[model samples]
Target chain A: MVPVLLISFIPLVRGIYIGFTDYELGGQISFSGLENYRIMLQDRFFWRSMGVGFLWTTVVTALQISLGLILALLLNQGLRWTSLYSVLMLVPWAMPPIVRGLMWRQIYSPDTGALNLILTQMGLIDAPINWLTSFEWAIPAIIVAGVWGEIPKAALFFLAGLKTIPGSLYEAAELDGASAFRQFRHITLPMMKPIMAAVVSLSFMWNFNAFGLIWILTQGGPGGLTRLPMLAAYEEAFRYGYVGYAAAIGNVMVIIISLFLFFYLRVQLKERTS
Target chain B: MQRLISWILYYKGFIIAGLLAVLIISVYIAGEMAIRLESDEIQTGPLRFLSLAWQEEAVAVVQEITQDWNQAHPEQQVELIQGTWNAVHDYLITGFETGDIPDIFHYESAVIVDFALRGYLADLAPYISDEMRDDILDVNWASVTRPTGAVMGIPFLAESSIILYNLDLINEAGVIAPTNEDPWTWDDLHIAAKKLTKDRDGDGVIDQWGTAMGLRNSANILMNQSIAFGGSFFYYDEQGDIEVRVSKPEKELIGNLARMLFVDKTMSPSGVGKSGAEMIPGFLAGNYAMVVGIGSWARQQVVENAAEGFNWAVMPPLKAVTQNMGVNTQTLSIPRSCKRTAIAMEFIQFLLSSENTTRLAASDWMLPTRQSSLEDPRLQADSTGWKVVTANAQFLSTGPWVGLPGYIEWKSRVANPIFQEFFSQRISLDEAAERIESESNSVLARYQVRGLKW
Candidate 1:
């Protein structure tokens, strides 16, 4: 407990304090309260990246949850080699984030990538499309990779939820002459609601703070189209030497994420109590 | 078999994780062992030199140089610590904050300037030997010298901007090959590119391009080579006034390059959002007759990776207003936190001696900063366009905006996006020029203010 408090709170408190000061390189910081915040308020890039962070989080989270639900339903059906299939599903999650980024970077390579190769071979494109570099396609391509990496964990959550739905409920519905689709609609969807909320909340925060996959994939390039808030803060602190400004950006992100989770969790609790 | 399989399956997760942990630990241990037998001990070396040279040839040469020093002076032994290009800045920042940056480190002059400005780098003006100072071109020395007259680092390796082209393609197009003495102007390049661009197999689509370049990361290229077109971009007057402009002279290279990309259709479209290094594969495949990149690419990429009989040659640095290419030398610096400044400087001087510097530069196919090293027979050869590569040395000048605080931010945040938009043809040329000027000025204004304080 002491170690945890020291590790977590020291940086946390230091970051919060730095956000109020005008800290930078050379260790010559003077406190200019709210000056960093004022700059952030007017900074167009910060707003643009914040908007992108939300768009990325919402899209990635929604898609992963839905895809996860589908995968969970399939796995819960107890198909042949069910255990093997479940283990095979861990491959995406098991790989390091950097490995995923590199793998996808190779897959998205314009000249020699597998994606472009398959697309050209399938006659989908007349020439190789620059997936990672093109302004039009870069964000969607990255989103696809993000969803692919996180879907396995989301599926595990839903799979656990699916297991607790009770075989008796399905049996009763079947005895009542309910169709497969009808039974799933009445039982699985309702039963999965709480787990869905938990998954959504967790995935939203995780995807919002994402840096590694996107940083490696794009470095927030093709004109800052893929620059998430983390990428922005990273540039501010490290690239631009604006440590205080970076901490301010981080503080803003945390506040935003917390506020979102606060209200979201409240709604979940309200429904559960009612 | 069944019992063994069951047992294995029961502990598979732990087994896999243990295997991964072992692999990582072993790789770390192997890297440590590869460096030295005593490297694992805390007293292995009193000094640590972080180097970013990753190429096997370059790494071997660097390791050999450091090992030689170690054998000679066991007391002041320097352990070579490996660093990567992508994360070096962040590592150095954290290291400096904790008062533990490398005793001696390798980085480009462009980047080391930031540290120097922040007072994180040691002043080397007092320690740099006169022979060493005179032997290196004054222009190379100018790159690492800040406005305060303090030399930040010793400039060592450099690569001038040059054009690499297929000789057969140039000959086939009936374009006279450009020599080091009489290089092509921007106009000459545009016209020749139009002539060389062809639709082989003639299916309405052009299969081959006259030239290709990855335009996405052209900020550094622009900063360096735009001087030839008389675009200093940032002009400093002796009166201590600064002017940042993006006018006709500044726009010439990008304008001609754009026309080649779109109007003439002589440049490859795939290079629109990529970098010159990324487009090298297409150049080697003979899909593009010419590739404009650093001189080192001709040596490293074309020499090492190209197919047999690729028939490639490099054009000397092109001339417009003049053939003055911007120089940003790869530098070795002593961090301010280091206790062994004198010893580190000596190690640096020894490491960058004429013989050692030449060998090191040759391994990486980069130019040595020292004039004596440039005269080395191995580097001064005519074969594989070495003559053409080294001939550009006379054109090297300290690039515009040298040692300017906030220059990195402007290049990355403002200039990169505007250039990417223009190259992708999403923005008009006038819009690009205007945005580059206005946005960069705002960024520089903040820097000017912060520079006074920090």
Candidate 2:
């Protein structure tokens, strides 16, 4: 337990200290205090990255959770090959994130992409769309790729929750003349509350720190439209050598994530008490 | 059931032992990866060297020369290892801290000053013989020399900045073509940019731009523009002090050129932060009239990607600066701690020889550093922009940036911010200069040591 806590806090402590100091790869280091934070606040890229991160998390979580719940309910029905379907649904989750990102990037490529080829062949569009290059379509294209990658894990959690429900409860509801929708509302959601809470919290954290997908896809470009916060941190630290500024950004991320977790826990506690 | 559970618990020891055995094997395998050591048996024999060049052709040329050298010497053999561009700096810095740097490695000309200041690089004045030094071009040697008056490495190549123009666009614009003797000035370049800017179908959108300067590495663009205006950006004064002549020039030359981003509107404001993606594809599609890039790009992109019917013209240096500035990205250096310094030095000489260096340049489309290599019949045989490239490489001036340890940080803290502030009209030139000077001095103060000159 001691080792676990120490390992957990090491990154936090390191990031905080590094944020307040000027760290160079081969040069000298000096304490800069809130100077790094001040510079970060003034940086337009940092703020732009924050906005992109929020949009990315929001869209990915919403789509993932909704699709997951729908898929879980469909699979929970006494459908044929339900076990095979559940196993097949996990393919995306099993595949590496970087590989998934690469495959999607190819599909969305401006020149000679499979998506455009299919669309043009079907006569859905006369000309191939420059999906990755165009400003209007790039983010949406990335979001589609992200949602595809996320739905599998969320579905697994919901499916686990679906299994824990007793068949007798549904039979009792049927005898009481409750409709299928009412049974789900009254029994299914209440029973799945704890699992849903856990899944949602995990999903929020996972999506917040999502780096590989964005890095592999757009590299935060077409003028930094798809730049996530982590990419901004990477550019500042490695490319620009603004270690202090990057640390400040990291600190800001921590504060934001902690606040999100606090609110999530508050809701969980209130629900438990009620 | 109780009996079966008891048996399972009794066999737990075997299970635990098996798991620990697997864990030990995995750890052993992982540990062995860090132990990838070449035989130390030959440490007293053959010399080992590493070349961190990304170009495959350059690597091949270096290998060919090493084989020939090893054949003649009979006892001395050399080893060359390749590293990625990103890894080169990190590996060197890490190596210096841990004392693991190779016998010789390619150091970018820009970062050579800092490495030398840190005492990570060996001074070539002792290793490089005078006759051997005389063979290298003077300006090329000057570019690699430290501010403290010591040569760090042999000049491998000269990569100068030149304007790559779309031939079809120039012909259609009805603008008088730039002759070899009378090259276009910054003013001429700007006028051409305006003529090239057009909304072909009158859609209130520019389908073609006159020019697009590299936004990511805009400092190079500013340096070239400053040279056009007869100003030096950063250089070592006679006293070995820093002189930022271009940043606060008499004409605000660098800032004036930066204003072209917004004032002239030749480059699109929409692609400011994201430059690499914008510049490469934009030029390839006939969307830009001209681009200011190095000789390597002229050979690789303009020549290779020239669409059928798309021919390119090579324009000479603009007049704001009389001296043409050439930027060399990577320079080779030998680490001081290496035991194979002698063999490494010999290999370095062999690598820089006219025949080998020419083959290296021809394969990679890189400009040859040697004066003798520039006149090679093979390079001159090409009717493409190779002739103009060689001419540009010959009379080029290559110092000004690359001399200070704080230059990289300054580009972000001082140069980029000044350009962004100027382009936005958020601050006056006076304020920008004062801020840049104060900040850069503080930055240099931290890096400056008694032995290290800033």
Candidate 3:
């Protein structure tokens, strides 16, 4: 506990302090209260990236939960191939983020990509599209990759929640002539609410803060279309050597995430109490 | 699990004795390691060299040089550390802050200015050998030195632009070849490119492009080459502070490039999405009649990877209003905290000697900064257009990006995106020039009046 606190808190406190100072790489740090934040407010690149980040987080988290719930339902059906399917679901989660990025890059290649070959054969389009580089398709393409890599985490949580649901309740409902859909609606969803709440909150937080996967895929290019706020902060701190400004960006992100989680949890608690 | 526990209990006495034996052996080994580590600390550790050479040929050259130095100086042997060009700047910055940096490291000239000005690099002037200093070009020396005359690093290899063209295509198109003595102007290349472009199958799409350049991350190349059009990106404003500017001359190269992509339809539009090295395969495959890249890439990629019976030649450096090309030299710097500074300098001097610098630069396919190496017969050979590439050294000059505090930020964030936007025809050339100028000035405004001007 002592070691963990030392490793974690020191950096956290120092970073917060840096947010209020004029800090650069290997340069003198001076107090410049709220100056970095002032610059960030006026910076169009910062605002654009924040917009992109909000869109990415909302789309990716919502899709992950929906797809994960479906997969979990299918796996719980006691099908013959359930074991094999369960193992297969783990593959995306097992591979590291950097490896996933490289794999997707090759798959998105214009001339030799598997995706282009598949699409061409299916007569989807006349010519191959540069998915990652295209202004219109880049966001969607990365969102798909993001969804694919994370579905398994959400699926595992849902699967565990399904097991906790009492089998006796479903058995009692079936006797009352409850259909499969009705039973799921009446018994499964309500019982799964607690787990859903946990997963949704965590997933939202994780998605907003996610950096490695998107960074590997795009590096926020083709005109800053996919530059997430995290990438923006990284550019400020490391690429441009604006440490104080970068730390302020980071502080803003933490506050945003915390505020969101706070309101969401409060609503969930109120509903549970009511 | 319970059965396994019972099974283990049955062999408890023997297991206990075995565990004791293992513990004793571990302690002995630990003691030995501690002694060795203490001895190493007293000896001040091996001089660590973090080399950023990743290509097979480049890595081989670095290893050979390190091996020779290590063998010659057994007492103060050098240790080779591997680093990548991608993460090197951030890695070195943090490493220096934590005092965990290698004794010697390799980096480029433009980016090192930030590090040098921040006082991370040692003043290598005291340790530099007179022969080595005089042999290296003064411009190369200026790259690693501060505005206050503090020498921070030794510059060894320099990269400039080179055009490699398909010989067969040039002849078939009836285009005259350019020579070192008389280079083609921007207009001449534009016309030649139009003639070289072909639609072999009579389809609406062009099957062959006149030339392709990996312009995606080539902001430095674009800015450097823009000098030929009398473009100086940074200047002192009315306040006597460095500021960004994109006048008509600065826009000339980009304007012509946009015309090639959109109006003339000679240069490959796809080239703007890829890197310079990525265009080599297309050049070799006959998709492009010519390709533009660093001089070293000519040797490292085309000369090495070209198919049998496929003939290729290097064209003279392109000229617009002038023949100058911006110098982006690679350097070796010692951290101020290095324990074995003198020994590190010895290795650096040995690695940067006339013959060795030539060997290193030849491996990477760039120009050696040393005059003696440039005069050597090896670089003057006609094979692979070495003469044409070498002749380009005469036009080398200091780029305005040098010693500018916010140059890298402006290039990557402001300039590169505008270049991409215009090249892709999404934004007009005028829009690109405006955005680059305004946004880059805002980026540069964060620096001090005299910051990194060296």
Candidate 4:
């Protein structure tokens, strides 16, 4: 308990303290009293990154949940190759995020990337798309790569949730002349709500703080189109040597995440009580 | 006895807490003793020298030099810790903060001022001999000297940007071959680039680009180009006043660069968001006929990585209004935290001696900073590519604003983004130039207000 408090809580408290000061690496530290926050509020890059973070979280979470649900449902159907499919589905999640990011970076390369080659061979496009370099395509390309890596975990969660849904409920639905679609809508959908909520909230938190994947892929480039808040905070801290300002950005991120988690949990609690 | 047992049980929690406190205190004492014993053991050993020379050849050279030093002075052994260039800066900064800085380390010359100003590096002027100072190149020496005339580091190797081109492609495109004596002008290079850029497969899209212009060092390149155009962002006046001059030449250079990137479209589009080091693959893949602003040290990598039948040659850097190139030097410095400063300086002098410097430079294909090493027969050989590098080094100038405190911020935040935006056509050249000037001035003002000698 002492070690935990010393190692973790001390640094947490120090970081919070530093956020209120004008501290820089190798420079004098003095309390500036809300100066850093004021600058953050006015900084366009901060707001832009926040917007990007929101979009990234929303898009990646929605896609991962949908794809995970589909895969989970297929795997739960007692198919002949269900075991084999499950192992294959876990490959992406098992790989390191940095390695996955680097692989996708090559796959998205404009000249020699696999995506362009496949698209060209399939008669889908006449020209090779600059997936990583284009402003319009960079974020979407990153999202696709992120979803590929995130789906396996989400699928596993839904799979666990599927196990808990009583087979007897589906059997009763089938006896009631309900079609497969009706059964899924009436039985599966309602049964998966709690798991879906957990998955969505957890995925949102993870994707919001996702750094390695996007950093390796783009380093927040193509004119800062993919510059999420985490990347911005990193740049401020390490590159710009604005440690205090970066700490403030981090504190704000925590507050934002907490507020999101708060409302989410509140809703879940209300649902449970009702 | 029964009454005493009941009383003890009633105070059990307090007794447990007291015992726990004693246990923690004892462990702390043991840990402190162990640390002290270990440190005492280390204190009796040799001085530590850290280096960011992780390349195979570079590491071999450093090992050989250190071994020779260790043998000569058995009592003053040197333990060399090798690391990569990417991690060295963070390592040094953290080590400094923790009061664990290595006695000696190699760093990029651009950051010498940053460290020196922070009172991390010791002034090397007193330790360096006059003969040794004279042996080093003027520009190389200037790179390590702080604005206060304190020499903070000793330069080891120097490099500058040069253009690499495929002779076959230049011949095929009917472009004039650029030579060290008669390098092509910016206009001449642009015309050749347009001609060399081809759609060989007739697919209505350019399959082969004329050149790749690396945007990673865009700020330095911009400063070099500005100097070539007879303008500079910062310069020292006769009275030693550091003047900030962002004017017409820099703006014109930006306009030309934007046109080359967007309108001319001769350069590779894939060069966007990639550093100079990262663009080597595209060059090796035959996607580009020429790669501009490639450093002298990258020649080996290019040769090794290029596909079969690939042949390349170096040309003197491009000339605009003048023949100038930006020189970047790698240097070694003894930090102020070093306990054995004299011994560390002695080892540094030995490492940078004529024999060792020549060996390392020859092995790595780098330009030696020492005059005698630069004049070595191996470096002077026509086939070694050092002849062109040395010739270009004659016009070497540390680009204006390199040693500034806010230079890193200005480059990463203002200059690089503006250049990228301009290249992508998100903003016009005029607006980029304006923003670059204003943003750079703001950074400068911030540093000045803090009384930094950047």
Which residue pairs show backbone clashes in model 4?
Answer: none
Q: Model 4, which residues run further than 4 Å from truth?
A: A123-130, A261-274, B1-44, B234-246, B307-309
lDDT value for model 4: 0.81
Ranked candidates (lDDT, high to low): 1, 3, 4, 2
**Lowest-sum lDDT 10-residue window in model 1 chain B:** B35-44
Task: Note the residue pairs that clash in candidate 1.
Answer: none
lDDT of 3 by residue, B340-454 (tens): 7888898999988899998887778788899998888888877777788778788788875688777777788888887777776787777777787778877777665436555
- TM-score of chain A in every predicted structure: 0.95, 0.91, 0.93, 0.93
**How large an RMSD does model 2 have?**
7.1
Model 4, docking class: acceptable
Q: Write model 3 residue lDDT over A1-274, tens digit each, in one string.
A: 3345446866888898999999888778999999888988898999999999999999999999999999999999989988899889999999887888989989998777899999989989666777877777889989998999999999999999999888999999999999999999999999888778878888888889878888888889877889999999998988878899999999999899897788668857876897
lDDT of 1 by residue, B1-454 (tens): 9999999999999998787667666866886676455433433357889998877799999999999999999888888999998889999999888665778999998888888778898999889888899999989989988766789999999867778888888889899978987888878888888898898988878888998887878888888888888787898779765667887777887887788888988888988877778878888888999887555645687778988888888888777899888888999999886767888999999999989999888888888898998887898776577787778889988766888877788889999988998988899999999898888888888878765421
All DockQ scores: 0.32, 0.19, 0.29, 0.44
The digit string of per-residue lDDT tens for model 4 on A120-194 reads 999998767778767678989999999999999999999999999999998998899999999999999998887
lDDT of 4 at A143: 94
Give a tens-digit lDDT track for model 2, residues B83-160: 776567666766766565677787667677666665667777777866567766777777778666687777777666
lDDT by residue (tens digit), candidate 2, A44-122: 6678899999998888988999899999999989799999998999998887879999899789754447998999899
Error of 1 at B447 (Å): 1.2
DockQ-sorted candidate list, best first: 4, 1, 3, 2
